[model samples]
Target: MSLSKLGITGSEKDYQLWISSAEKKTSYPLTGHEHPYGIKMSCIPATGLLQQQLEGSTSASALQEAFLEGPQELQDQFILKPRHSARNQARKQQGKVSDKKTVRKSSLKNWAFGCISRTREVNEHPCLPPTKTKQLFGAPLEDVCDNDTLPTPILDMLSFINHKGPFTEGIFRKSGSIKSCRALKKKLNCGDTVNLNDVPIFVISSVLKDFLRNIQGSIFSASLYDKWLDVIDQGNDEDKIKATQRLLDQLPRANVVFLRYLFAVLRNIEQHSSSNQMTAYNLSVCITPSMLCLSNSGSSENFTKQISFIQFLIENCLKIFGEDITCLFGETSVSSDNSNITDITDNSEKVAGM
Candidate 1:
């Protein structure tokens, strides 16, 4: 058979040599009637072109490029086969899975780091020990003093502010020097006698706020927080006042005494609103957060009501707390103090009489 018929450009001697080498390297039959490797003889031109490039360059890269640049039929027969397509799809899926795992790990790492950072911050600036806090700042009113009287530090600070802070502009609204406040706190915590008169008016005000803020259960008590908010939602001022009075009657005697004293002081300050610019409303706004254990989920409307409730307390201090000679520092027992008490006193008496 002529070598040219097989698409070989070489002499018969070269074709014989090529055929001998192919027979040794491959298991394909080389009969002239059929193409080796089961391909059709008519498609030999594309395969023949790839073979020619491989013969010209003995490099494996050139051989691969030849197959890649060959005709579509040749490419489909070799590189684009079903098995290769499946393998490529598997690799792409694996890469996507790896990417998602990497992203999840990164997010988890960031979350862990954030939690650790917050923990460190808390450790670095931890709150005072419970015993120390109770000693220096607050305890339950009943636990600390007799006759529903204020804690010593609280009473001292309030009395000083009452005497010197009423006419001070922005009494509770303004912040004092942080350094001074801390120093005063340190002194108080150490059981050192702190003369409020020697401290700045703003500092004394700030210390009082700090005291209330650090109190164990807050002045109003957490159990009563929702009820206090509900008091503001009452239909009218009359109903609201009555609700507030009932709530006040529910307080532990110590809280009632402290509340009465604190509101009396706030009312006194509000009376000097012309000079201080801290009206009952403003005082309420300034004092609410410290006095109440605020809820994070509470809406702005609830906050407004909280402020309004506080404002009402300040505006009607005597009516809500009643007028007891022993409300502040009096040593009279709860039973004996009832006679001088007014609206709230009447309700408490009714409850007792019941």
Candidate 2:
């Protein structure tokens, strides 16, 4: 049949009328967008099916029967295109998508937990020296694993999460979701040389620390200060813990495990509080809330509740993964010269041989 015979050059009214008539006769409706006749393209399988059904069908009744009784597979080929199948599969793999602003909210909650809950002892310790203090808080950290440079969009996204700018609602109150985490994961994977899928726990640890350190100070730095202060003023310990746990539960399993290891490692590092000056407490306040509280953010009652949530997280991590924390991540080996020295720290003050 010629292009004009299919009514391709004429108005779409004829095409719509034909579609309307076909739907009334057939059990299943035909599906496709009308194409321009000038593009002489034939999808062989679909065209072949139509040709097979039309051949030797002289009467209208015969043609209708031929089309309706066509092989099930052939009918499906015309009804559903390959591209449509592919698009459906893509949507299925990625569940519901949360908006960028909401996804950033998840990062903000995680950031707050890392900065506020994890490091209480360090902030109050009296003996840390000046340089050590700066190293833990102010100094820019070198990449912990092979100097992997994270892309700028990831950092910008983190800033948005941190309430750095372009603010959104419920910064401190609402928790993140698994859907949001997966969406953010896909975002991080895009254009990334190192795909984040099944990444090593240690590398993830480095990334988490880098993320926590960088979440401070942007255009909207003071953006959520007042709201969080309101949260603090309420002093609702139960509500805060519940909210924090909801955020933690929404995190990917890898992240939950990484946080456990990260906190333990940071605590170990802070054990040398006198030497390194980065006590666990000081580390907790590392993110430095923009709220204009007189005392350091750690002194607030809200911070105390946050610490309780941190303990809860650690307990849950232990319950879930019963392995010893010391053996999991590669431990920093003691120097050969330092091997001969007997460590007389508080935890090891009374050695068995002594």
Candidate 3:
């Protein structure tokens, strides 16, 4: 049998874990004379022992054991006092007391080298995990949604502009301060809540000449586009092919809700934009014009009209059966082909996440 079978496979690294463990167990990172791996620690002469074990010895295990058992001279070579001293004395020179511990330059170099080796080994191992960027959601769309959900301009408005009053110097910094989130969250402690199913609708029972004229075939989400067709399929098959002059003219109060909601989100951000993205853009996705119109005209007629319009719109949306219906409250919609009439009458999902 090869002598290697009886010998320790050794290196400074091989000893490191052992040394550190011993230190932790014994409360001292002691090495050499009392170390468990070697044997001649008590018997061999210092100079001869180093040479014999490294290049001259044949009986490896006995040599290692002897090195441990009688390595008396080595004790003084590293210690601050005579060979029999149990600990090193230079430790006091380094201004350490008690279970004094320190890291040396050599130790750090070894640590970095070992880290690099392990990482390289891991890279070579196909089963190892690839490095990744952390995100709240695993999917990129969700990440994008998390990142760019509300536009930057909108968040700035809520945090700064709207909250800023004459007495509010540095309002964003003041209210969005770390402390504010705590106070606000405490006041708004979360509880399971029934979502409000309130949405004012706008019923346009006419040929949307106004919208067909204004929108230039820009909308692309296939599901939403399908829902738009279903909405058009609406209002009395008896009301089909009816005439209108312009796009906004045929649209319900879409523009009004976009403007108001934009303003509300802005108020939360504390920025006042005389012109908001949704509010300022006369051209928006098809829903924009209808929602805007419902919000603009004032009077009980408007409120009654708004409620009737939302109900009608929701009804048409049920025919399409989609998540876009939830978009009325800025929530993500689900995929369904035919929604139930009672589904929308409940309106629970409509108010969720608000």
Candidate 4:
């Protein structure tokens, strides 16, 4: 049939009647609007299906089988020409949609347990971190394994998991869920449902410290103050343990790159003591909160909690190691030589007799 035979050019009433009739027979949602030219829209899939069904029957010998046996009034109503995105798109793109602003709400559980939950969801990766190619994910390994850069997925997984664990559970278990935390955060009429029964608030607060530390050392600087600013917005690793302690003291709630150098210093100590297991365990306890904090990368509570934990550690480290041997760990510094050389030789001779 020719385009002229479809009666596509006509008054708006003629087009509306056809649209109404097509919609009744089509399963696909149908919509049309008058353009400056004429009614235009993409063809609904159902329209073609209807045409095929019609062509198969004897009564409608072909779509060209005009209903000669029926009333002549509706004869000029059939038309087909397609244009436009979709009706839903029109409602969204055109100004016909509602004016109220839409706000998104996420789960409080996401904030609290978000990191771990997300990690568990994607655990199907075959090779995890500590593998030969760990650096690809920006994962902070103490020593490069062999000769690989890292698989991209492994890096992503490590980056996500190592965020500062201490922060995740600390904030999550307290708030119940990530959504609840955000609701409380936005002041959007949230109800009280924070849980703190069995979980120790201090441990959670400590994990937050690790989060603070990782963010802080991500820069190159001399002054603690500059490093302070680099991290203060998120938090400072230097005083994570301290800030964490202070926050803990307050209300009962609460809350990388350099890590290679950290591992080196720790390794030196282990070599002297002939032990690595205890050191690893101690560190695991120290850094778990940080990993947890990273788990909820969405939570700012992770930042605060991390800062305090690091601060507490620094204070304790000073007391634990003392001012004398503490300075030995710095990169470009040297220890003072002792003046008791003769006394040391005499001690060696005395020990030989035993």
- Specify the highest-lDDT model's number: 1
Per-residue C-alpha lDDT of model 1 across residues 119-236, encoded as one tens digit per residue: 1123434668666343666566577654544556767776666655566789999999999999998888667887675798898888888877876777787888889989877898
Stretches of model 3 off by over 4 angstroms after superposition: 1-127, 134-221, 236-354
User: For model 4, what is the alpha-carbon lDDT of residue 103?
Assistant: 27
Q: Count the backbone clashes (under 3 Å) in each candidate.
A: 0, 13, 59, 54
Cα-based lDDT at residue 44, candidate 2: 29
- Candidate ranking under lDDT, highest first, comes to 1, 2, 4, 3
Per-candidate TM vs. native? 0.53, 0.25, 0.20, 0.20
Candidate 4's TM-score: 0.20
Where is model 2 poorest over a 10-residue stretch in terms of lDDT? Answer: 345-354
User: What is the clash tally of candidate 2?
Assistant: 13
For 65-175, candidate 4 gives per-residue lDDT tens digits of: 332112233211233323232344335633522332232233534221121111111233444655352221122322221222222222222222222222232222232
Give the clashing pairs for model 1: none
Candidate 3 residue lDDT tens string, 1-354: 112332555443333221212122221233443433433333324446446545666576665554443234331221111222223433433353333333322233332112111111223235656766432111222221332243222222222222222123222122233353333323222212211122100111011212212222221122233333343445763242131112223222323222233333223222221222222121122233333232234466444443443333333332322324333333322222212112212222222233
Residue-level lDDT tens digits of model 2 in 1-354 = 222322234333322211111211222112223332332324422445446777654564444344334555432222222234435644653343322112111232332112111211233345556552122111222221112222243333322222111122222222345454444444443534443333432233334334444433311123433443443334455554454444445544433343444444444444444544544444444323321232335566766544443433333443433345433333333322322322221211111111
TM-score, candidate number 2? 0.25
For model 2, state the Cα shift of residue 257 in Å: 2.3
Q: Is candidate 1 or candidate 4 better by TM-score?
A: 1
Model 3 TM: 0.20
